[model samples]
Target: MEITLLQGIIITIVIMIIVVDRHLEALFIFRPIIVCPIVGAILGDLNTGLLAGGIVELAFAGIAGIGGASVPEALLTSVMTVVFAHITGNDVATSLALAYPFGVLMQFTWTIRNTAFTAFNAPAERYAKEGNVKGLMKLCFYGIVITMIITGILTFLSVYAAQAPLKAFVEAMPDWVINGFQVAGGLLPAVGFAMLLRVTLKGKYVPYLLAGFLFATFIQIDNVLPVAIMGVAFALMEYYRSGEKEPVTIKGGEESGI
Candidate 1:
């Protein structure tokens, strides 16, 4: 089945049909796992979306936010990569490059949504002051709904719009441009690492960080199985050392310590 360009765009738009996670109290259309495949399947390129998504997922698998700081925006990156890949004939690496910038840009979108929610916070505060459960309910629902709906619509629209310019841009550029982008792609992990370092670069953990990175970069132990093994080994060793206990023994009414 041939996928018309407009149909591709519409498929991207369907990403806006978001389902809320009642447990988390946050809004998103779908998990990246779900979203990426859908994008690819719609574009008649599910394999491409899955592959690119797998790369993107692994790259940021360790990312998380602590103490109200920012985290790498995976959702935006995933969406952009899928849309851009579809537009650019689904080049995996190129989709990565296109998605990377959007992640950075989406950080600002994060700020905006957070800032808008701040206003809603004030109303919630007022409700608390007045003991208005209904007010709180209204504020929470409105905040979550409005933010998510706006986010979905905007993501769908921007990604849909971005397709044309991205296609045109790729088509117009010389091969050298893509080559340069590829060279940059080799360096892209540094950005994720730098963001990671902001949190993980403790004096005590520096050696572990260096060792893990070296193993990943030099020894090529980055695949899931090897990394998992290393992680389990590290955890076990740490536990053994930390769980050391004094030995106690008693023989024939005499107590002895080894």
Candidate 2:
């Protein structure tokens, strides 16, 4: 599906909002899983958007930012991957594999944005010295605006210009390599889960984790929601069981004093 000018403008607006607006949980809205579908809807292909979103979301799920560090540029990558997949008639995996370079490119943009913001420090300090609270607020607001403009422009160009080049690249790829990407795409989510487990797994949760693995692997439960429901049930049972009062023991078989 080709992105029209109006659609491009809408998407640019959406990307800007997702990238810059965080006061109202913008991060949640813009996560690959959510943003991909919005992009797909813009391009008139919801299924491809949803598929690409879910795949990319899982693949990068464990890689969140730590302190001042950066995580994978999931927002932009998800948008581009879904756009590429929709336009090229390619599988979600192929689009995912192809989207990595853009993520790296976004990293550079992120660093540049941070560095650019430092230029505001002197002006901010001057405003503070003069007790111009409004000036400081305006400075911060403009900084955000500039950042959003930059993000919107990049997102527009990436989605609008990527269509032709991605099509050519996919067309020229060998069958074996394409198949390899598909397999890799299928397996990459597991790596994300492993990364997540590295940070989150504990001895107490291991049994529940093992049970989930058994349910999925042995029972062939491919859908995740059912496993999640089972986990919730287990947690509730544990909560109630932990709250139960221990049986009181009578001393010397004598009547307890009231």
Candidate 3:
């Protein structure tokens, strides 16, 4: 599927919006789960977009930019995965495996951008000291605009310009290699979940986790909606139970200060 200029422009604009929103930490739509579907809609392949998004979302579930730690670029990976899958007619797993390198590349780019942006700190401080509101506003505006433009341009080039080469590379690969990618991609979500559990799992939560696993594994259902609802119900019950106050007991089993 060849991407037209108009579609490329629209996708670029959407990427710009997502990137700016990510920087502002507003709306929280920068995640792969949200970004991929939107891009897929634009590309006229919502199913592939949804599939790619879900897999990538779970794979990166435990990963986040905490404090000074660096994380892979989820937005770029999602966009490229959807685009590559749609254009090359590849499986979601293979697309995800292929798109991961792009995410790492963008991660490096992000680090460089952050380092470069430090130069603006001096100007920002000077404007603050001089009480120049307009100057400060202009600086912020320029910073956002530059970020938006750079992200948009890079996304466009990656999606449009590299499509042919990427498609060729995928086509040239052997069946075993493709299968290996599928295997790796399929394991990534489980690894991500394990990482999350390592951090958040507790003794009290083990039972609930086991129950969920049983429900998901032993009981075959059309969807996981029932299991999800059960989880929510348990969570609500625990919340309310925790909020209740225990009755006070006196020496003779009588309430104190009654």
The 0-to-1 C-alpha lDDT of every candidate, in the order given, reads 0.64, 0.80, 0.85
Range of the 10 consecutive residues with the lowest summed lDDT in candidate 2 = 249-258
For each candidate, how many residue pairs have backbone atoms clashing (under 3 Å)?
0, 0, 0
Model 1: worst 10 consecutive residues (lDDT sum): 249-258
Most TM-score-accurate candidate: 3
Q: Candidate 3 regions off by >4 Å?
A: 245-258
Off by over 4 Å in 2: 22-27, 220-222, 237-258
User: lDDT of candidate 3 vs native?
Assistant: 0.85
Instruction: Please report how far candidate 1 places residue 189 from its true position, in Å.
Output: 2.5
Off by over 4 Å in 1: 1-14, 17-34, 62-72, 201-222, 246-258
Please say which candidate is ahead in TM-score: 1 or 2. 2
For model 2, what is the alpha-carbon lDDT of residue 247? 60
lDDT of 1 by residue, 1-258 (tens): 234657645664464453234113266334456667777777777897797677666555455444545765666677777777667664666667767777767667767777767777777888999999999888767765765676666566557655666678777878888777666655665666666676556555666666676778777553657756776888798789768873563433222211
Looking at candidate 2, what is the lDDT of residue 105?
A: 77
User: TM-scores across all candidates?
Assistant: 0.75, 0.84, 0.88
What is candidate 3's lDDT per residue for 120-206, written digit by digit as tens? 999999999999999999988988988898788889888888888888888899999888888888887786787678676776678
* Global lDDT of model 1: 0.64
lDDT of predicted model 2: 0.80
Cα error, residue 225 of model 2, in Å, equals 1.8
* Model 2: lDDT of residue 118: 92
Total clashes in model 2, counting residue pairs 3 or more apart in sequence or in different chains:
0
How much is 119 displaced in model 1, in angstroms? Answer: 2.4
